[model samples]
Every structure is written in structure tokens, then in C-alpha cells.
Target: MQQNAPFELLSQLRSEAIALAAQGLTYSTQSAGTKNIAYVVNGVNFYCEATDVKEVSVCENLMIVPQTKAWMRGLVNSKGVLYSVTDLSLFAGYGRAIQAKKGHLLLLAEEAVQSSILVNRVIGFRYFNESDEMSSLDDKQEALDGLSAFVDKGYRADGQDWYRLNVSKLLASEQFREVQ
Candidate 1:
């Protein structure tokens, strides 16, 4: 056993070095350029800056608020923080989201917003090069109709167009602020 001690230490150091290198590679890939968190709302694909989302969790334990807008799902207490929840499908005029057994809650990163949006499903992080961006999405009028005000850019990847939703602008818009 004593004779193998040095070899064991070397093997452990090699493993640790490999692990650290992999972590650094992932960080470089994610931080070197922008990545988007893709999600589906009413069967439409949408993207938001990964940095804009602070957390993603299952939609559960929602406490309905009284006399609010129809699209306002209610309040959700997550990690001891109260967030106003909105049904993205309904809010975007795409109709109500299908009552799935489990939906995703995208918690915004902004401290002042204190809001989360419910989506049909989350498609995970997607990376798009600058060449993938499209200046105009004229063919996707139906999907952009209600979300146009919040979406200023679009990208195509994996044979689909992903509309980027500016969560900051959406949260700051007068229409969203008028939630009575």
C-alpha cells in the first residue's frame, strides 16, 4: 500500500486538474458571448437573455390574488421571496396556457421587478452567433403580433426562429404596470 501512495496522489491531482479545466471551458463558452434561455409559450418559441433570469423552478404553491388582471396568475413565494406571476401566453394575447401538470416559472433577475412569468415549457440555454440573427421576422406575424413591442430581435437556429423577449422593457411598459 505504501508503494502505491505516490501514484494515487498523482492520479488524484490529474483528475482534479481535468475537472477544473472542464469548468473553465464551460464558463468561457457561456461568458464569451450571450446565451438565451429558450422557452415555449402557447406553443411559440421565445428567448430571453440568460442573465435576465435569476431562477427557474416548477410552478407550484401559487396564491391567487384578488381583483387583478386575468393574465395575472397570482403570487408565488419562492425562496422566501414573493413574486407576482403572470401567464405569458395570456399576457401576450396567445390565449391561456394549457393546464399542464407542471409549468415553468422564470423568475426575473431585476430586484425592483419582483416578477415571474409562467411558460408552457423551458427549452434550455441556446447559443446563437451574430450571423444567426435576423433583422426582420416579417413572416412570423402571428407569433409577433402581441409580443412585438417587447421583441426587437430574432434569431434562427435548429430550423426554428426564436424571438428574443426583452424582459426589462416588458416589465417597464405602461401596459404591464397598469395591472390593477
Candidate 2:
């Protein structure tokens, strides 16, 4: 029994190391422009920095607030956190996004200003490569009017123009903070 003690300890340690590695979540740190999540709102496809997005889920039990802007969809309790929901399309001057039978919500990172924006559909995850040619909307003359200031940049991939949605800028904008 004494002779087997060292071997037993080694086996137990190896098993624990394997289990811990399996349970740990690893994130990629490649030079590619940052992992992004693609989503659509009001037929406009946009991608958001994955780090700035906290969670995405189907919105439920949303309580409407009266006498507020049409873009404001009210508040919702998601996983014990109350989030102020907004219609991204309408706020961006792209017309209202009609909620489907099952509406989708993308919760922003918990910053000083945090809220969930309604999205039409999630296009899954994609890497925005750093080498991809990017251009500012102002230079490209593709201004989105009210939303131009919130767009970080634009790039083309898969024959489609994908805009980087800047949540920080949007949250800091006066239009967003005036939710009274």
C-alpha cells in the first residue's frame, strides 16, 4: 500500500488539472480586430465589439413607460438585472423595428450608462480582422444621420458593408442620457 501512495497522488493531481482546464473558458487574443458579434436591426446589418456586449437573449416581460420617446421600449428584468430597452433602428433613424413573435435583445456592458438594445436577429460570431480595409462613414459619404456619430467605422466582407456599432459613444450621447 505504501508503494502505491506516490502513484495515487500523481494520478489524482493529473485528473484535477484536466478537469480545471476543461472548466476554464479561454479567450482568443489574436491581432484580428477583436471578436465581434454580428446582428441586424431594421434590415441594417451591424457588428458590435464582443467585449462591449454582456449578454444576448429573447426579451420577456418588458414593462412599457408612458410619455417617453418611441424609441424607448421601457424596462425589463433579465436575470435579476433591470435593463432599459431601446429600439436601435428607430433611434438610428432607420425606421421602427417591428418586434417578431420572439424579440431579441443585446445587453450592453455594465458601464455608467447601460441598457439593452433590441435587435432583429443575431448573425452569429465573426472575427473582424485587423488587416481588413476600413473607412469612416464620413469619408465614404454613407452617413446614417443621427447615428453617424455612434459608428466607429465600416468595413466590407463577404460582399457586404458591415458597420462597427460603438455602444460607448451611443450611451454617452445626450440623446441617450435624456430618458426622462
- Candidate topping TM-score: 1
Candidate 1: list runs displaced more than 4 Å: 1-32, 98-101
- Total clashing residue pairs per candidate? 0, 0
TM-score, candidate number 1: 0.79
User: What is the Å distance of residue 81 in model 1 from its true position?
Assistant: 0.9
For each candidate, what is the lDDT?
A: 0.85, 0.77
TM-score list, all predictions: 0.79, 0.76
Q: Clashing pairs in model 1?
A: none
- Residues 101-121 of candidate 1 have per-residue lDDT tens digits of 478999999999899989989
Error (Å) of candidate 1 at residue 38 is 0.7
lDDT of 2 by residue, 6-120 (tens): 9999898778777777989433344345788899866667888888889988878889999888888888887787889988877877766548335688889966656988888
